[model samples]
Target: MHQTSSRLLRMTDDERPFTRSYIWPQYALLFAYPHRTSLFISDPNNSCDFKDLFSTLMVSLPLTPHRVRFRMIDFTFTSDEAITNLGSLKFSQSNRMPDPKDSSRVVTTTTTTTFSMAKEMARSVCQKFFEAKFIESVESKIDFQNKNSVWQLTPKGIHILERFCSRNGIQSAHVKAVIDSSRNPRQLVILERDIDTDKLHHDEQTVEIIFRRFVGATVNESLSADSDSIHEFSRSDVGVRMIKHKPSNARPYEHVFTGKATVDWLMDCCTMVDRREGLEIGQLFLDLRLITPVDARAPGNDTKFVPTKQAQYYVTVHGQQIAGWTEFDDSPIPADPNSGKSREGAARDSNSNRTNVIIRNPSWRLLYREFLKDTMCEENLSFYLEVQEFRAQYTAAVSITGDHKIETIRETLAAAYGLYNAFLAPGSPNELNIDHALRTQLATRMTRAVGDDTAMMQSLVEVALLFEKAQNSIFKLMSSDSVPKFIKHPKYGPQLRGLDAAAAAAYVANSNMSSSRSS
Candidate 1:
């Protein structure tokens, strides 16, 4: 390769300019450090001649091993009129006095200038280069209204190059900070994005989550009390609508009624949909009471049935199975027993299919329990049963839709249970077992119920204190290993306390306590 500058001449081992015959896999370095924030642009004051800019870029390339190869090159040139109107690029000049050893005595001066280009136009140029392989494929784009074109590198390209460079020990200090920052994981906050359309219905269900954000440290106050005195809260702030993507929400909710098989198979059995596997699941929700067709079946009415709202769940056989529908006439449809079609044409009417069974606010306890049951085994049998019972009682006591303090307590308890079982449990699974719908619902509900950070923290602290008290009380009786064993033994008990120490020792010896303990 011919070098026009000394910088280009100092290329390390396999580093070379873009060439048709260059072996990309064999080379362990890239042209620039690829990042989302940084972009390459030409000097605004310079002429738009592509050849001159390209040459300058090669010569000015920082002495650093790049983690990502150049994806595309952008050449942006402002019109003469625009340049004249915007004025010459902003610049600064520095003067250097001539030294005594210099014979020519010419004062050296240097200029630094900031360039401006139309970013959209630059992106277009980069796109063309990417398509032609003049550079690599297009990774991403940055939208800017100002006059500047930027060509950014792709993350995959950067990662591949980084791994290659690491293997070769070609570390570059210039890109070290960028690499480290990119490697660090980001803090996650629970949020929901609202959408007006059911565009993603095929992929997953969209569930609404309700939560409140506070402006200050009154989170505890907000959570403990009502949010009536608004701090500029909006309907948007109250809740966010999020789509529950598949498999994440598609984990089979196990039920004894669904037989020993998964809820997926049970759904298949119930629905005639083309993709029957997970199709019916969207229509089937957890009913805590294990309400059957007989339980819900009306005495004289054959077509319409409305059981007690307590512990109820609604799953639609058609459309998205969420709430928000016009109230249906609870009375049975007047139908001919022979034909089974309604005389009022209600069966044919689209409105007749609407039912009240779909609950807008499902029991949080049941929803979480059914979801978590997928990960449990015999070891957590007691916990599983406790969750099942807790859900049943919770649904029976609380209305489906309301902002009662009791509801907030239920949400907090559910979150606490999830944290303990899925996160803090011994031999717990590493990944979060929660589905998108449940997460969105629970997060919003808890946020709304608690009020703010301080309120939520206070609620959690109270729960923790209660749990600690309960644990101390329960363990007091069985805290020592020897006490419970002695109480249970038929030969020793409270009655033995009245006997002398000699008699107790004799009894212990006769019962073969040492042998029993060893066994």
Candidate 2:
């Protein structure tokens, strides 16, 4: 939205058309992609800007650290064999002496230094040829484990040895020294401090600086441990260590609509956002209380908790592992296109690419009533998870049903999708703004009022019970004093006792009426 300038032809920076026909929306939409966005239409009157939406997603982006280090060589070959051709390592050219009786005989001297160099050269050559698999590169180091004979890296890595340092409001070069030592550590996997810390600003340690120091030159290319090198890392001000990194992460809102936290860390960092053309961002907020179903036993037979997918995530963002992203994509650093299809395709590709498939351990979700707080959560959470449930009901409502309770589920799935931001969140992305709640409610009410009546019980018994509990909620708006007063004429009350069933029927009828009025 633009405020018409009093000066007609006057132009401000935001509205200036960079391209011949393009105009930048003043407020860019920050979308929390992977969100069910069709919900925005629940209240058709509530218009939001198309530009304010944004999706910050965790992409498990691949990384290929420029430097690499190995602690224990896993090959069956001996260390000697590992360095066989690097230099004439096994050959020694030292002077040999005969017995005293043969002292007069000539003494011969052999050259060992040249042999050692030759062997070293051979080792380098062999590594390039056969171990090329280990030479994978990345934008950053990756973390992984192995049973034996294998080393792995992940996008989940930290930079080492060549850290940047700053102190007293001024950045220093010393941090670089720390980084250098680590990059070429003498020992493949030495403790962080053991490498070198001599010249660091003796007293200060900020997380940013610490992060760099810890991640810097740790690779085993060349242990750059030198007194001069130690002197290179700069120090920091006095109170640095106490500072903790404020992860620029949003909660994983995949559960904005349903699910016990399948992945806890992810949900807490979820953020909600939106973006569209021609409008200013009107709303963006965390549902701090986005609802999902609780753990329950099987209806009759099972005792162990089996969490329902209701009120759980309606959508999810899939990504590759950080360490293997590059091996999968052949690129050390990955880019985010914010295209839901692309990211999902990448994930499917990578998952299918695995030669060994491993199923992760499963954990249980505790009873929601016992562990969670929202009183009406059960009422608000999703109950019907399948589209078939609505088969005989409203077609529009049935279109969005899913087998899995996800971050979102609604009637406009075909036109809506998730977006992912690469930098902020690692696994889950922020979401776009959509009036999911309002729209869902409207759909629920509409379906009950006009479509199939039986499915209403499957969907909204909880709501009916709530009304029963707080009878005042039902009568409060019906009082004669309220506008559009309930004309309680003698004819209106005939056989009109507010039985639960009758009330349910009336609500359905009214809901249909309202939906039609709006349309």
Candidate 3:
């Protein structure tokens, strides 16, 4: 809590001589009427938990201290007017109201009571502000026109309110509500400390950052820890040790985390944040009520503090450990394209020219060309062109290695059928116009562009052979005498009539089986 000065303002002539009757009327009228600022206060204690809204304000607020002041005016309505207004207003507690039929009793007492009630309410607000240490002091002055005492924020109070308003991106009206203790904190606490970058260490105290962008849309609740608990994608080699914690509070840690080896491996994928830093981040989140302790009976249940795919997060430690973000934007550093690869003079064995040619060819472009006359269609052609361009761009940019190369070749094979299907479509294009010679040309260019990777080369050759076999089977079936029946019949209709129903089925089955085995 921040320390504040205790300089009290002396009451003015009109403000003095306060009594229970004067306070009750004011309190009742204020309570009975609704104010926009009051909506921000969910609890009477002036403590709040506004959820994500509060977090947003904390992040966007300016750190530099500043000051702002506003003069509070007396209630627009007179005591009698407030009492009269209260007749039509609702009260939470019916007992707070007096009999309306007794006009004499109401006139003599209710006017002071209404004003007094409002005064008490203001005093309560002042008390809340003092408790929260939100103000240095409050002052009062007589309004020259009305001789009514008005409250105002002292310099310290103004500075604090201004800072809060700036950080929260709220207007002066909202700031006034906060100063009056009409608004509470949305969360348990808002941590404004600057994260220390010196605490960062790699390897032992760090984890390799791994970022994944999902292909489709995702929701906050669906990506939450409760939906799918965080765990390592792979196991670690490090030996296990007993976790140091008491039994009653240990189940959550035990259930959420895995073995030491696996934990290390999982952490390796996260950006490095040491244990001490992790503790600080965790404490901040805990104080803000972002995360609560896991229940003993139902572990890994709903979590407010856990970072879902929806929330930005820094690398964490242990189970649900929070830590500093890698960058100001909170984005993870991308994995280097050259990571783990031999750079400059590092020795790497060379493959034969023959294998090199196959890699460059990938031969999938050849396969696409071969099947183009049989399958080209708008959708197929569009996708085929996109994949082709992507592969070309990727090959030209980097030295092919590991999964990157393998994935490219895999994509080639995956979309290879589109060309075949397009060529065989109802309004098929001319087969003669499509060049067959480009197969070798495409393979050569691709191989040169992709450079060399053993796994990628092998995958390319394998898929090429399969594509070749497919084209051959397709051509053979199209040219055979059985083709006339295939052409005469509807797409899904009968063919190979020499054999009866059973024989035809058996023959077709055998052909498919042979084709599958060959591929």
Candidate 4:
């Protein structure tokens, strides 16, 4: 089912069914039909208007099998005959009868103005449908004025329309029959279900707790006589063993546990029911970058945690810090008297000059965030991280190519709204200092109702771009204004310098130990 939906959504321009020239005539005819007595003016920019127009088209336009030809080949396609009669309709005053009392003149004038406006409005709506891949040209012609080219609903179009009818309780038996016959047989068993947002949130929290507990439970230890080797042993008697892993490229030795042991720990301690569930939770940890494979370049590399003894992984430094495990080697480095700077001062100077380096390292980022908090400008860093997370989700949402694409997009939009309310909205608790014009643009786009999949996707894209701009603004503000102050702070600066010196000392000690082991 997802395969089919993904293929339809990814249709290329050359594979598209409709030509640019065919859309206006068909929609103009539908809009200008004299029998459309109930037609009313609506805002072209509003999503509700688009929905109403689509519903009206579905009801008013004739749907039947029509003979079409492309590349000297005949095909039976479903479409309406509105395009055939587009030339017969006229929106000018000449089409109306003369009225001496001027009462008839008023009616003619109104009809002429309304019909012309409606035609253009319909054309605009039709273009949106084409852009959304809901309609395609029957003849696939290139000419802008090709009246011979009719429009037909693509499979994706048919699916969305069916959903629209079902959602609104609008029954069209013929349309249902067409959908049933056209739908892929394999997708019949896959019923569409509403996403359980609360469950998703709960699961995320649960996984976070599990990850923290797992990292806390596993502590660095010396499991062998070799001083260069280190292993992380579980605090509990689960007997999980993490062996020392040293890469062939002379990377430092790190503790790594087999995937099977990790899954076992998740099931035995984390209350996971089965191996499948344990493996899934483990994979979630991998996705969050809490853990990584020791042999990433191995054959058949997968991001997912494979529940096998052959697969070895290690907890990341960021994961360890977040889990409340501060295992920094506090060994002191001797001062260089000849350099005219103390060891601590040299470390501070090196780190203070590199704001990018500070943010990239989890330890430095934590300290920097603390420094910002003391300065009463922590919101800048908070907003920056929030936008970073939103950007990741936006990327994932747009790249989705499955039946759940709509659901993923909806979730991303919800996150975007939350982000705006928290940081971008006026008078928001963490209101960010951003350009007023950009803020207004976001407000306008977010305030509008999203009526359909097309509107929702479009709004999501627009919001993502605006959020990116706001993120960039905040990042620049922090880099130019706050970062320098943080690096030179009287208290946090020394602490950061200490951390850098400890890390350097630890690296040198590890290198010495490795050399002695080799000897």
Candidate 5:
């Protein structure tokens, strides 16, 4: 390889960048450091530092390496002018910046102004958390919209956020702070005329969230108080409640149901949306008691069947399967039996299939007599699917939509899944003919300097995920706009979205109280 700049250092060791794996402990290193916020971007500004850090990870390598690259079919990571410069980012410190009214950028149609400023602030804080986690090579993009609310992170930025959230867990205020940190009216864009309640189904939980945002909860307030929610509060100051690192919305509940239908129903139940966002509630109350047919069937299953009148859905992530529900609402069975088409139709209808991840696992069962301790309602979720089982069962169940954007997304997921497929098959990225090509392409001059074969190879998967995560972080920055972006159109891909955590949950179910694994 040839080089040109004074800051760039050439490497002598051919094996320096070479690594057997880069996945483990990646999250650990990120959380340990929290002040630096430049590792998320790929900027020329941090060239020298990136070169040094590449040399560090190479010295220590994992004993057992597991790697696979899944291909997400029908996913669209590709972009034309419309979505161009959306995902793929490459910024130079130019003296000139785009004017919002410039010919290149157009707000042809006015977007509904429900965008959340707190969510935007949260993205920035998350970006900082990620940057702090990195050792070096941090490039920061503080202002996304020096033009608008779009913020970019350095590769350093990527390293910090990716691991911090993974290790420390996502805080509600962290996202809010991201929005609050960058509150410049001249630069920020929030269009708030009115929201359309008709677009959302009436949901009590949904209504609660709306009111919670408009007039958020606090430790001082009663858990059952909706009357306090009726009085108007400043949307900006309303969500604030302090945390170890930042102040956020008053109360942050783990939302079990992120579904639009469910949330709309919850909103209409409380009559909050119309009052809060200047929206009008329509005749959605009729369907409040009804449970949709699809809700009856499992995500990867056909032939919807109600779980039994005595059945109620319970959800929990891996290791916490017996914990509690993020939501307590019943899965309303839809009255219209033919309201939707067959299982095949549901998968293709992006709108319908997109949010099935919200559903609880039918396989979820409680170990009532033994480990069950808490009053918190518990249901079991496990993730044990055979390739043949997944394919044979969900083949007809999975949508074969060819939407390029969605396809691109699916393709990316496929890369990770390929590794998963290979893992059970005892396969590797090479066996699947997949390498860290996605990540290697963005090493820039600095990563290329100290990055060796192993590091480069490990970085391949890390970088690919890093990019997708960068996209996730950018959207996840704000609670209102960003949260919906990730939960709405997940980049972890759809299959991951609907993760009952069962497959993983089962693995860690009884082991929750077990001693931690020894190094």
Candidate 6:
């Protein structure tokens, strides 16, 4: 068992269970409670009555080399208040007493506990906490008592507290500030020391230079013929398009480029060696909001930048304005009279061009799957879809209530293990190309047998978290590596263009018919 788990299991049988599900809610409540700071007492070893400790002030003072002193009263009071306010334990009077004036009437009043009883209960709870290694005294005392010595949360306690706050969505700024200020700075030094300062600076400079060069490059309208050949679109021809705003019923044009065009420019001009590197750079640009998907109705809506010929993006207006680049003229483009194409025909062409069949249309998924099969990387897509299905199942199982909850969780666990064996386990056929550390962690979790409901739920949560990380890694692999090759494939590229052409012809025919009838 992990050290934390072993510590949690150390509680006495008479004490309340120290399981995660049981303790986290209580921890959150106590951590979030407000406590008054007390002035430093002159006598450090002052003793007090157990009941009086609840009302005693808490001191925040540096007692040791790097450790800070926190009063026991603050923790006791917070624990008392948290336990008293709990819905299950709230003080209530079940028995009614006869009224003084009228024997026929009865009065109902809330039951109040004696100070001694409340004090004892809080002390017992705090003692359990100390025994479980949640908190320790600055003086290194083994037992918890009502003394002047200060106390602080142990690493285990902080870990649980952090997890509880995250799980419960408790965004208490005051709580965070307190935790941050109280935490030992030595723990963070190792993480800070691992960062390569010079390399990080170089990366930042390179990204900034790339962004400047990319935005300043000339852009133009995409032609119908350019869709057939990825290389046919000139650097200057990869420009802006006037797309109609469906909600506002207004035409707005923005400087845009196809994903293929962007990658090509990065590889050819920016010295990017391979398609994956170029796609990663493009994704970085999308993440920073320097460029945005044209299909997205608003900025910051989409994070995944598809590196395909069909995918389009715009240089964000804010970014362009900041860089002092001139905006595209808002005026409508004059129709090409020589081509003999009507306004309706042009609209149909734009509609057909906007189709991203691979993602939007279910029918095209099979075609993409077949293409992946030919490339021997069909496992990537299969794993992605399986993880998505497992996520849906896990979500539904979590919503289950009552007696069926345990059984539902068991079923979810089965599904989780099935996913793990198929894609993540070592020596398993079709094992995924995930990080070695993640696979090893999954292996460790999967090998352990869960005995009880608490253990089962804990295992399930850990597995789900690890699976999510693996899913993300696989998704990036497919997006940056496989998807680009699939898009540029000779067989698939022509088929995609053919579908677009056929759709365009059908749209123009219907549009002309509609126009004739309206006239």
Residue-wise lDDT of candidate 6 within 187-250, one digit each (tens)? 1100000011101112332353355455543444433312423222123112322222333324
How many clashes show up per model?
A: 17, 111, 33, 3, 106, 1
* Predicted candidate 5 versus true structure: per-residue lDDT over 331-396, tens digit per residue: 543444532333333333332222222222211111110111122111110111222222332232
Model 2 TM-score (2 dp): 0.13
- Please tell me which predicted candidate would have the highest lDDT against the true structure: 4
Q: Residue-wise lDDT of candidate 3 within 1-519, one digit each (tens)? A: 011111111222233211100001111122112221121111111121111111122222222222224543321222222222322222121111122333223211111111112444434433333222222222222221221222233222333444334322234443444444522222111111111112322221112111110000111122122222222121112211122332353442222222222222222221121223333443343344323444423443333233332332221232122111122333544543542232211212111111122112222122222233234322232222333433443343344566545544433432232232223212222121223444333223222222334544554454345344434434333333222332344521221111122223333454568789999
| Number of colliding residue pairs in model 5 | 106
Evaluate model 5: give its TM-score: 0.20
Positional deviation of residue 196's Cα in model 5 after best superposition, in angstroms: 20
Tens-digit lDDT track for model 1 on 1-519?
Answer: 000101111111222111111111110001111111222222121112221222222222232222324533332122222223222222222323222234245333232322344544434433332322122212233322223333322222233233323322234454343334442111111111111110112212211110111111111111212111111111111211111222224332211111111121221121111122222322322221111222234472222222222211222222111222223334643433533222233333211111111111122211222222333321122222333333443344343445445444434344343333232222233222334444433333322334443455465555444334333332332223222343344532322221222233333343466579889
Cα lDDT, all candidates: 0.26, 0.21, 0.27, 0.49, 0.24, 0.46
RMSD versus native structure for model 1: 30.2
> TM-score for each prediction?
0.16, 0.13, 0.16, 0.32, 0.20, 0.29
Q: Which candidate, 1 or 6, has the higher lDDT?
A: 6
- Which candidate has the highest TM-score of all? 4
Please give the TM-score that candidate 1 achieves against the real structure: 0.16
Q: Is 2 or 6 the stronger prediction by lDDT?
A: 6
lDDT of 5 at 210: 31
Ranking by lDDT: 4, 6, 3, 1, 5, 2
Please state the error at residue 443 of candidate 2 in Å.
Answer: 28
